[model samples]
Target: MRGSVRKILLVFSFVLILLGFWFSTTNAYTFIKGYMLFQTDQTHIVNSAEEPSKQHKDNLKQKKLYTIRPNKGENIGNLLIPKLNATLPIFHGTDEEELENGVGHFDKSVLPGEKDNSVLSGHRDTVFRKLGEVGKGDTLIVETSAGSFTYKIRHVRIVDKDDRTVIVPKPRATLTLSTCYPFDFIGASPERYILVADLISQKLT
Candidate 1:
């Protein structure tokens, strides 16, 4: 009976070890994939008008071509937060797969450099890990194939996770960056950290 009990205990220990290894492996894979996706170039965009193709071709002659027709899950642009010294790829959607790769643009919101709220989100523990270090008067820059826009941080606030007021349309062009609150939390965060900025300038490349 003693020997049988010893064998069962050993098996249980081995199973626990395997579970831990699997967990680590999965998380590592996710992080590595996300890193690679962010480093890759994104030259695509959804064209709402005929100017897209013509614009892209024209830019191509200048060796500045951008704005290819985008499919789902394509890279859109890059988001730079000077205060945090962080630059992350911005994808088209806020879904899990897209967010896993980098910061994600809310598709329902206006595009960057446009005349409405352009909302971007990321995981607090990853891309926006240093977000808390940012403050008012800082700058946020978004670079896309169409152009680069500079925003001046006007406000920073912590809101409930479900708050929709933060993303409401504004009379002036704006940029909104969001992430889960309590950056060091172990599980699903219950609050959101919001960074609101206004478009101060833009340069069409």
Candidate 2:
């Protein structure tokens, strides 16, 4: 009876050990599976966040580069004013000679159709003699080697001739036209007649 009891005790101990081993193995498998699933989900989230950024960079790289750079005093384009039914030549520099020939483009500003302020200036007595008749809601079109850009007038102002705000940077594509104020002023005018326009459309050439 003592031997039988001892044998039963030994069998019970072995069964307990087997149960413990099985439980531990099962828990280890569950933990490993959970960890792998967590890692996969993290990887997926990271990839989702990075994909748009990568695509944005690729799109920026694929955009067309504006390569129309004209020398100072060179004819670069034409400015068409629909209200006045006029088309004027646009030159690169705002010098006296260029202004005498046609409208003068401020070299410091961006070119027409670009993503910044493009400024054009003309004499009150010549190319822009009737510019006073043009007000807000008028359309201005610029045709350059790069493309033809249409802009709609948004604001009209008469600022002092020395005001630097006329050439300030714009948030988007803009066109600024300036001429001596009082269109009938005998000589050098004291103020500038300004027309600010926003780009409406563009046709690539």
Candidate 3:
């Protein structure tokens, strides 16, 4: 009787181990595919209200934060890269799951064109794969339903994981782009690649 009980316990443990392994592998693979899908279909501009904040920036004057939300009857402002002549979707409220589709608005960052800096992030392998292809003078366009805002790539830098300061919101019209570094390395990336952009102009749609 004791032997039979021990055998049953061993079988259950084995089954649990197998199931755990399967779940982990499957989800990781799904997320990787989601990384590719992240090029488009991941914006929720429903956060259409601005708030007051007191954060300091390395540049620009202080101002209130702008609010954002998905377009109601309006369309999502498109994201275009002049160098690749490539374009994709942009949306508000970028979350972990939403990142599986395309560009995600950094919920912590300021909204576009109101006051402080508006930062956006996406998977480098998917939406931002071409981002590495952008040169210093290359152009990034965010055409909202209201107007089109242009930004020129100013500088790109790689930093350690502890450096979250690079993404702080400033009082200027700027765009911040970030992704994991050493793009080809497998099994978790430890570095960050960041792009700093200066707002060039805003054209009404």
- Best-performing candidate as measured by lDDT: 2
Can you write out model 2's per-residue Cα lDDT over 16-62, one digit (the tens) per residue? Answer: 99999999999999999999999999999999999999999998762
Model 3 weakest lDDT span, ten residues long: 44-53
Model 3 lDDT tens row, 123-182: 778887766777677778887665778899888888886797777767678887777777
Give the C-alpha miss distance for residue 51 in model 2, angstroms: 1.0
lDDT (C-alpha, whole model) for all candidates: 0.86, 0.94, 0.71
| Global CA lDDT computed for model 3 | 0.71
- Local distance difference test, candidate 2: 0.94
Instruction: Please report how far candidate 1 places residue 186 from its true position, in Å.
Output: 2.3
Residue 94 lDDT, candidate 2, scale 0-100: 96
Error of 3 at 30 (Å): 93
Candidate 2 wrong stretches, greater than 4 Å: 1-10, 26-34, 56-65
Q: What is the TM-score of each candidate against the true structure?
A: 0.65, 0.84, 0.61
Clashing pairs in 1: none
